[model samples]
Target: MRKNSSTTFVFIVLFLFAALIFVFRMQLVGISGMITNFSRPLQAGLFSVFNHPSNETNKKFQQVVDTLVSQAQMNQLKSDNNALRDQFATANIEPSQLLPSRIIGLPQFLPGISLPEQLILDQGTNQGVQKGMPVIIKNVLIGEITKVESATSLVTLISSPNFLFTAQTQNTNTLGIVKGEGADKVVLVNVELSDTLKIGDIVVTKGDKNLTGKGLPPGLVVGKISAINKSPSALYQSAAIQNPIDITKVSEVFIMLK
Candidate 1:
């Protein structure tokens, strides 16, 4: 009977313990939810601090990149300006008379095959650029402004097939018509047979001005005569002219303002 009484006491203790646990289950769930809510923001803040590509970090990185880009652009502009100043001093041209322009585009062609016919300049009508204006580097005539836009211009190089200008030998004053034959080849054509032609003669522009005074200035070096073609049967003799500077390599030039 005593053993039976002891087993009944143990069962009572177990039942009371289960009843207490059931009564507190909802409170325990509420406490767990409160803890999760409180830690969520803290966890997120810590993660952001450790992460390399957070929103704040990205904004700072972008600001740094923008600053670098602006600095590089400013440096390039300064360099271009300095180069133009040097060129003006070397050419003995008044700064007010020449508009400095950067070559923004080059004619596309295969290397070692042909020469460029035209160059695209950064300055245009908005910068006082006009068509038929002479483009030069130092004292050498490179091309003329054939077309103009608001912010850009096209220069037809001296080696273009359509280029035509009157030129004279610097030493002898032997006059001939300068014509372009492509592939960086220029020819002094329509020369009289009696005019003295030499292989090493330097040709220069015989300046011509229109009523508006927009034209090439005299004494701009064109090129040196490479070979003389004097055919006895032909009425006029021609000579091949070689430019001292490679037009394709030119990065800057000046436009003579009218």
Candidate 2:
């Protein structure tokens, strides 16, 4: 009878232990889930820290790139300044008489099909730039200021249809009226038929003080004579001028301030 009683007691203890386990199962599962969720975020954070560059590293890299770009721009500006100084010296022009200007905009046209007839400069009336000021690259006349605002100016290129100036040949001193036919075609017309015309003659500004004042200085190179058209029945001859510098490629220029 005592042995049977002890077996009953063991069975009762086992039953109570199973009841406690069942009652606490949900709480145990919740604790385990909480621990797993906490560890997941920690693991992800560590992985990101190891796999990706830090914000400071990215910032430093960007700073290095910016410095390189700034240095390149500085070098380019220095080169341009040196070139302008050399050109001024060669042209016998005083640097003080020139207001260095940057080309901010180019005339819109189909590339390789059309030519530029105008340019926008960064200087305007605020910089003492005014209409009728001659724009040049060294001793080569490119255009003149036609309009000015407070901070910008409009330049009408020598190749514009409305552009007209007096020019003369360097070799023969033959005088003619320079006219623009658009599309980068400039012509020297009204030349007397008896005047000597050559294929390689250099054309320069005739420098009329009464007509344009200091706007178009004398001896400024306009272009070279590429072709001459003459007719026995015509009253005058015309010559095709080839500009030395491609106006489309010009980035910087000087405005005669005097």
Which candidate comes out best when scored by lDDT?
2
1-258 per-residue lDDT for model 1 (tens digits): 999999999999998887887887543545544554454456445433433345665555446434533443444355457768887532232343888886666655663355678877777666888899999866678899998766667899898896999888755669999998877789999999999998877787877667987667766778779999999999999999987656544556889885
Q: TM-score for candidate 2, please give it.
A: 0.61
Question: What TM-score, computed on C-alpha atoms, does each candidate reach?
Answer: 0.61, 0.61
Give residue 247's error in model 1 in angstroms.
2.0
- lDDT string, candidate 2, 1-258, tens digits: 999999999999998887888887544545544554454455445434433545676556446434533443444355457768887532243344889986766645674357778887777666899889899876678899998765667899898996998988866779999998888889999999999988877788877766444548766777779999999899999999986656544556899887
Give the C-alpha miss distance for residue 173 in model 1, angstroms.
0.7
So what's the TM-score on candidate 1? 0.61
- Candidate 1 error regions (>4 Å): 1-96, 111-113, 210-213
